[model samples]
Target chain A: MSAVTYETEALTGRDFPERAREELRDSQLRGNIRKATTTIRAKTAEVTGELPDWQDLRRAGQAIKREAMRDLARNLEALEANVSRAGGKVHWARDAAEARWIITNLAQAAGAEMVIKVKSMTTDEIGLNPALAAAGIRPIETDLADMIVQLGHDTPSHILVPAIHKNRAEIREIFMRAMGLDHLGDQPTELTAAARRYLRERFLSAEVAISGGNFGIADTGTICVLESEGNGRMCLSLPRVLITLLGIEKVLPRFEDLEVFLQLLPRASTGERMNPYTNLWTGVREGDGPQEFHLVLLDNGRSRILADPVARETLHCIRCSRCLNVCPVYERTGGHAYNSMYQGPIGAILTPQLRGFAEAGSLPYASTLCGACFEACPVRINIPQILIHLRGEVVREKQATLGGRLGAENLAMQGALAMFEYPALMGLAQRLGRVGQKAVERDGRIDWLPPGLSGWTASRDMPALPPQSFRAWWRSRRGRP
Target chain B: MSGAREAILGSVRRATERMPTGVVELPGYRRALGLDPAALLDRFAERLKDYDVTVLRVPEAQIATTASARIAERGIRTLLIPPEFPEAWRPSGPTLVPDSGQGARELNEIGGVMAGCCVGIAESGTIVLDAGPGQGRRALTLLPDYFLCVVLARQVVGLLPEAMPRLRPAIDAGRPLTFVSGPSATADIELNRVRGVHGPRTLDVILAG
Candidate 1:
C-alpha cells in the first residue's frame, strides 16, 4: 500500500478501550437506543406472533443467503451476463481503493459535481463520502434517516435506523445548528415535512444518485430496495445518473426469491408485516427511473472471506439491522463505536473481511457473544460463531513479514500456540501458574498480575487458580500419566 | 430522446449483471408453516399494524362502501382513481382523477385512490400491480399519501418467485409493474421512526372475496 492509500484506509487509531469508554459515556444515546430497540422488538414480537411459519421464512432466507455466498464467483458471473443482456453496466472493484476510484470516475465521467445517495451501507464501507469530498464532488443523502445522520455529520448507529441514536429533539437541533433553519419544532409530522422539503430540492436537482440494494436478482438482473420512506423512491428514480454499490452477498438466486425476504426483513427489523417501499428495476425502461444506471460490485474482502470454509457464513447478512437492535453493545455505543462504516453483528464479521484485521481487529471482540443478535437475525447468521473465528484470524495475523517487535499480542499468541502443541509444556505452564497464583492473589482476586495479564484482571476478579486444573485431576484419576 | 433512452437502458442492463443468484431450497417449508392460510393473513395484518401501516379487510361488494368510508374517515379529499375503474366502484365523496398523466409524476400529486392488481402474497401480505387496466402506473401506487388497493383473495400468490413467471407476459410487454408491501416509513433521525416519509402514510388493503 502506498502512502496515499494508507493515508485514507488507516485505522482511526482510536484504541478499543478508549472508544468503548467514550461511547459508553453517552448515557442519553443509550437511553434513546434502549427505548427505540425495545419498542421495535415489542412490535416485531407482536407481529411475528401472528405467523406460525415465521421461523420457516427465516430458515429459507438463511439457506438462500448461505448458498449465494458459497457460490459467489459463478453466481456473480451469471448475474453479470443477465444484467448485461438486459442493459446495465457492471464495475467489479477489488478493494475500497478500486471501488472509490471507479465511483469518482463514474461521477466525473457524467460531469456531475453534485450527487444524491440512497441508504447504502456498501458505499459507506468504502468510505465513499470522504472519497467524493476528496475529489471535489458532493454526495447528498436522500433517505430521511440518512439525511438526518449526514446533516448532523454523524455516523449511522443502526443499520435500519442510522439515526437511531438521535431523537426528534436532536434532529430539530441538528437542522437548526447545521442547516441554519429556524423555528424547527419536534413534531414527527413537521420534522418529516421539513426533511421532505429539503430533500425535494436535492432530488429535483441532483445529477446522480447512489443506492444500495437489498437484494440483486441473479436471474432477472433486478435490484431491490426495501424501505419505509418514499425518499428511497426519489433517490432511486429522480436522478439522471444512478449508481448502486452492492456487496456480493446481497445477490439472490432468482427475482422471485424476493417474496420471502420482503416478508422476513420488515418483521425482523422494523416489526412491520411488510416494507413500505420496495423498488425493482431490471434495466432502464423508456422514461422510467434513472436514465443512466451503473452498478459497482465490490469484492474488497469478500473474496478473502469466500476462501474461508467455516467463516464464510459471515457474509450472509442482509443488513436488516435486527442484529444491531438485539446487540447489547450496539444499543450502548451506537454505530460509530465500531469505528467502521459497517457496524454491529454483520459489521463485526464483514468489516474484518472487507477492510482487513489490522484496522478492524477490535471489532470482533466488541461483542458479548450474546446470541440475541443471531436470534434476531432474519436469516439466522451465527454471528457469535463467526466472531470467535475472526478473533482467531486476528490472533494469527503475524505471518512472516518484515515486522519489528511482532506486537505483544502476536508474541503472546505464538507462545500460547507453542505451549498448546506440546502436552509437557502445557502441564508445566499450568502448574507454574497455579504455584504463581499465591503470590498475585488478594481477597480471591489477582491484585497485580503480570503486565500482559492486566487486561484479564482489569475488570472482573480472576478467581484463585482453580485447584489442580482439570488436566491434572484427569491424569491422576485415569492414571494416563 | 430515443438515443439517450437507449443509452440509459444499455447501462441498466449492465448493472443488472452485477447481481448474483445461488438459490437453495429450504427443507419442509410448508410443513413448518403449518399450512394455515387465514391465520397467516391475520399475522400479516397484525405485523403491518406494528409497522404503522393500517390494515382493513372488506367483502368484494363492500369495497366501494368501505373505501368511501375509509376516505371520509381519514378526511382525504381530492382522491385519484384510474379511468379504467368500474363506475360503480368510485368513492362517493372524493373527486376521482383519470389515470392519464401528462408525465410520470402527474398521479403522485393526487391524494389517494384504489387500484386493481394482478397478485397478492398472503403469507407476507404484499400487493402486486402489473400495471394492467386499473393499475394505472408505478407512481399511482407510490406517490400518494393514503393508498387503498382492492385485492381479491383468489389473486393472492404464495410466493413472489412463483408469482413472476405468471407476470412475465406483462413485463415483456413493457408494462410497469409495482409490487407494494406496506406504506413508506423511515427511522432516520437518531433511530426515532416516523411513517410516510416519501410514500403513503396509510395503506388500507381491502381483501375482496
Candidate 2:
C-alpha cells in the first residue's frame, strides 16, 4: 500500500483538550459563538419542520452519496471526460502541496497580479491565500465574513459563518483598519454596505478568480456553488479566467441528485429554505462568464479515508455545520479548538482519520458521544459511532509505541486486570480502598486525591468507597458466609 | 498530472475492492408539491415575499404598463435587457440597452436589468435563469443594482423536483444557470441577516399569467 500524504499546516500543533481549555477562557468568543449557534439552531428547526418528507429526503441523499462513493473512480473519470468535452481543463492533485503549486502556476500563467475569491473551505484546507501571496499574487476575499477574517489576519472559526466568533464591534475594527475607513458603525447593515463598497471595485477589475465547488455533477459536467451574497456571482462570472479546486469526494453521479441535496443543505447550513443565489455552470462559455476555466480534482488524504469502511461515512458531510450548532461540545469550545478546517463532532472523527492517528489522535476524544450530530446531519453520518471507532484506532496506535506500552494509563489498566482475575486480590484491594478513602473523604464525596489520580478529581467529585463490597454484602445477606 | 490521476484512482479502486459495485437504489420520497396551478402561483408569491422580494401579480397584457409604473416609481432611467427580450413587453419610459458584451464597470452604471426566466420553483420561491436568448449572459442580471424578472405563469413549477426536468435542456446545451431566490443577503455578521450586499438589491418580479 502507498503511504498517504495528509495536510499538516491546517492541522493543530497542540492537542484538542489543551486548545479547548485555552479557547474556553475567551468570554467574548464564547458569547459570540453561543448567540450565533443558538439563533441558527432555531432557524434550522423551523424550516426543516415545514417539510413532511424530510426524513425520506435525507435517506435519498445518503443513498446517493453511498452510490457515488461506491464507484468513485468511474464517476470521476466520467466527470473529467464530460468537463473536458465542454471546453474546460481538468487537473489532478495528489496532495495539498501539488494543488497549491498547480493553482499558483495557473495564476502566474494568467498574468494576474490580483485574484478575487469566493469563500471556499477547500481553498482554506490547502492554505491557498498564503501560497498565492508567496507567488506575488494578491488574492482578495469577496465574501463579507471571509474579508473580515482576511483583513484581521485571523483564521475562520466556523464553517458557514467564517467570522462567527467576531461580533459587530470587532468586525467594525477590522473593516476600519483594512478598508482605511475614517468612521464605521457596528450595525450589520453599515458593515455589509462597507464590505460591498470595498469589494465592488476589486470585482470589476479582477482578471482571475478562484472558487470551491459545492457539488460536481458527473453526468452533466456541472459545478454548483451556493451563497447568499452576490460576491459568489461576481467571482464566478466577472473574471476573465476562473479556477476551482474541488475535493474528489464532492462529485455526484447525476444532476438529478440535486433534487435531494438542494433541499437539505440550505436548511442544514444557514437554516434557510434556500440561499439567495445558486450558480451552476457546465464549462467555459463563448461570451457569458469566464473565458477559460480549470477544475482541479484534489485527493489530499480523501482516498486514504475511503480505505476504512467505518470511517468512510465521514465523507458524506455536506459542510452543513448543523452538527456544530447542536453539539454541546462545539457550542462551548467552538471551531478553533478542533485545530482543522472541519470542527465539531464531524471534525473529531474526520481529522483523526484523514491526518492519521499520529497528527490528530487527540481529536477523537474531544466529543462526549452525545449523538446530537448524527440527528442533525442531513446525510445522517453516524458521527458518534465513527468517533468511538477512531478512539479505538488511537488507542491501538498508542499501544504500538514504546512510550504507550510503559505509560501510566497502560500500567494502571494492566494492574487492574490482574486484580480482577483473582478474587482474593480483588477483595483485598477493596478493603484497602475503603481504608484509604478516610484521608480524602469529606461527608460522602472525595473532591481531591494524590497526584497520580488527581486528574479525575480535578473537575468532578468522586463518591467515597462503600463500607462493604457488593459481593460481600450479597453473601452476608444470603447467609452464605 | 496523469500519474497522480492514475495513482488516486488506483487507491480508490483498492479501497473499494471488497465492497459491492452495483448501483444503490434511491429512496422513494415525495418529490413534488402536487398543488394545482393557482395554488402553486400563490405559494410561489408567498415564498417570494418571505425572502422580501417584491411580487406583483398582473394579467398577461398589463405587464408593460405595470413594469413602466414600477420603473417610474423606482426612478430607473436606463434599463438593460437581453437581445431576444420581447419588444411588446418593453416599458416606454426607460432607454432599453441590449446586452452586447458590456464590461462589468459599464454594466454597473445601468440602473436595472430586465430578463425572462427558465423556471420558477414555487416551494422554494427560486427563479432559475439560463444564459439563453432572453436571459443574455450571466453578467447581465449581475452587476446591476436592480433586477426586474418577468415570469410567465406557465413557467412556474410546484417544487424543485418538477423544475429539474425543465432545466435539463439548458444543462444539456451547456449554458450557465443561476437560481435567484431573493436579493443578495448575508447573515455573517453575528447571524443577523442584512439584505442587499452584492447582487441586485431590489428584485422586482412581474408574475404575469
Candidate 3:
C-alpha cells in the first residue's frame, strides 16, 4: 500500500557551484523577477485582505500539518492501499530515476505518445519532461503557467507562479517565439488570450494526464489538487489514463484536516481566504474523470528524511508558496538563485533537509532569517529554525569532508570548543582574547576580515571581545563563583 | 466504496472518531460573532463586500422574478441550482440542472445558483457553503460560469471554523460538503487572474430580505 519515490538523490556530490552561478546573473531576469513577484504579492494581499481569522486559520493549518507529519507512515500506507484497492495502480519510486522509469514504462505500456501534465513540482524535480522527451513521448505542461514555462523551455522561477520571472512583455516575446505569433501585443489580456487559445486544443485533446496532489488524504484514500485553472480539470477529466506523481509527505490524517488547509492555503499562497477550486477524488469512477488512475508515490529521499528525526518535518510542506512571496532574498534574486525545484524560505529549509546541504551547495546560506516565511507560512513552519538546523548539518558535513579542517577556522572552533567544554580553559581563553582584542579593534568592532569570512563581514561587523572576562565580571557582580 | 478500501476505510473510520464531535455548538457561531438579531442582514452585506462576492440586495418579494430577469438579460442558459432553490426564484429559459453528483456535474459550462450557509471573515472575503438543507447540491455551486448564491440575513457567520460545529452533523451523515471563496479562477496563466476556469466565472450574490 505504501510507496516511496526517493530513497536518495545519488547526487554526483557538491561540485557544481560555478555552473549554477552563471544562470543567476541575468538583468532581464532581475527586472522581470522584481515586477512579477511584487504584482502577485499585491494581488494576493488584496484578495486575502477581505477575510478575518486569517491568523487563526494559519494556526489551524500549522496544527494540521504537524499532525500529518507525526503520522505520515500510517497515512501514506492507507492512501496507497486505498488507491490499489480501488482498481487503480500504485507505483513506488526511490528517486527521480526510479519515478521516470515507472512512468515511462506506464506510458509505453499504454501506448501513449503525448502527455498532458498538471502543475507538479515533483515531476519537475524528477526531470520528467526531459526523460519523456528522450523516451520519445512528448510531455506538455497543462497548467497555464507550466505550459508557458514549457513552451519557453524555461525552468520555473517561482513555486506557484512559475512564470513570475517573465513579465507581460517577456511573455509576449515567449508567446511570439513559442506560439509563433509574429505580432503579439504586449498587454496582459491579449497575451492571456493567446496562451488560452493555444492551450485549449491541448486540454480537450490530450489522452494522458499527469498530476500532483496538494494533499493525499490517507483515510478516504483521496488525492487533493487545489488549482485556479480549469486546465487541471481538462487534464484530469479528458485523459483516459491519468498518472499522478505525489510526494510521500503530502498525505494528511483525515478529511477534516482538509478544512483547515482549504482555509489556510489560498490565504497564504495568493492571500485568498478560500481557493477558487478544491478537487478531491477517491479512485477512478465508472464514467467520470480519468477511467484509469495510477499514483506514483515518490520517496526521493523522504525515507532518508524520515531517518533523520530532526529534519523530517520538512516533508510536511504544503507548497503554498506564501513564504516565497514575502521572502526578501527570494524577492531580489528570485527562484533561479536557489537552483532547485523549490525556491524561497520553505525551499531554503525543506530543500537542504531533503537533498542535504553537502550536495545542495550554498543553499543553506540563502536566508536573511527575517522570519517572514515563518509568519506567512500557513502551517506555521519555523523556517528560520530549520535553516539554522541545516546550517549545522552543512557545517558538520564540511568538517567530515575536510577531515579535521586544516584551515584556521576549524582550529579556532576546536580550540574554542575545548576551552568552552572546560571552564578553567574557557577563563584562560577569554582572558587571552581580552588581551588580543587590541589587534582587531576599531570602535569596539572588527570591520575588516579575511577572504572566507568576507561574505560575513560585508554585511556585519564582529562585536569587540569583552574587555574583562565574563567569568570575572559575573564573579564580581554576583560576589560568587 | 466496494473494493480495496478495508484498511484505508478502517483508518478513516478511526480518524473520524478522533475528530471530536460537538467540540463547539453550531448555532452559537452566529451569536459568538455578537450581532443583534435585527442587524444580521448588515453583517451579511458587509461580508459580501468583504469576501469579494458581489451582492444584489433586494426585497424577498422581488428576488425570484428579478433574479430570473437578470439571468435572462445576461443571455446565460443552463442554470445549475441547489436542490432547495426556492420555487419562486426559478428563472425562465435556462435549464435548471440539479444534483448531478461529483465529476458528472462539472461546472464547466453554463452558470449556477447556490444558497450560502454563512458569510463571515470580512477581511478574507470568505463564504462557507455547506451542502446542507438550503445550500443545494455541491455541483449547484461548483459547476457553473456564473454563480448566484442566496444568503438570507439569518445564515451568515464570520468565519469558516465557526461553522464547523454546525456543519458536523451533516458531515457525519455523509452529506455533501463544499467550502467556496471568490469566483473560480487561476493566476497561473502568465500570473494573470482569469475568472471562470472550472467553476463559475462570475459569482453574483443575492442578499434576500
Question: What are the lDDT scores of the predictions, listed in order?
Answer: 0.72, 0.90, 0.67
In the range A1-481, model 1's lDDT, one tens digit per residue, is 0011221223466655567789788888778878887887788887777766778888988877766655555567677776666667887776678889989999999888888888887787777888887787888877777777788777776777777778888889987776678788888777887877776666667788888888887877777887767767777766678888887777887655776787777788778666666777766655556677787787666655655766777777777777877788777777767766667778888777776777777788888897888888888888988899888777667454436237766677679989999999998988888788988887766757677778876776667877677887877889454
- Predicted candidate 2 versus true structure: per-residue lDDT over A1-481, tens digit per residue: 1111233432545688888999999999999999999999999999998999889889998999998998899999999999999999999999989999999999999999999999998887777888898889998888998888888887778888988999999999989988889999999999999999988999999999999989999998999999999999999999999999999999999999999999999988998889999999998988889989999999999998889999898998899989999999999999888877778888788777766776778888988888999999999999988988888887777788899989998888888989999999999999999999999999989999999999999989989988878999888899555
* lDDT value, residue A306 of candidate 3: 53
Query: In candidate 2 chain A, where is summed lDDT lowest over 10 consecutive residues?
Result: A1-10
CAPRI class assigned to model 2:
high
DockQ of each: 0.31, 0.87, 0.20
lDDT of 2: 0.90
Question: Whose DockQ is higher: candidate 1's or candidate 3's?
Answer: 1
CAPRI docking class of candidate 1:
acceptable
lDDT-based ranking: 2, 1, 3
Q: How close is candidate 2 to the true structure, as a TM-score?
A: 0.96
Estimate, for each residue in B1-209, the C-alpha lDDT of model 1 and write its tens digit: 23333333343334334344544568444422343667656755654555555667766777788888989988888787864787656778888777655343555567786887887765556777776777765656666678887777667656545566767776555444565767766665544566677677788877766
**Candidate maximizing DockQ:** 2
Q: Is candidate 1 or candidate 2 better by DockQ?
A: 2
lDDT of 2 at B7: 94
Deviating ranges (above 4 Å) for candidate 1: A1-13, A45-50, A108-113, A133-137, A205-207, A399-435, A443-447, A450-452, A466-481, B1-25, B31-79, B87-96, B104-109, B157-177, B189-193
Cα lDDT tens digits, model 3, A22-138, are 545777777766766687678667655544555666666656665665555567777777777666788777677888998988887778888888889988778788788778888
Ranking by TM-score: 2, 1, 3
> Candidate 3 falls in which docking quality class?
incorrect
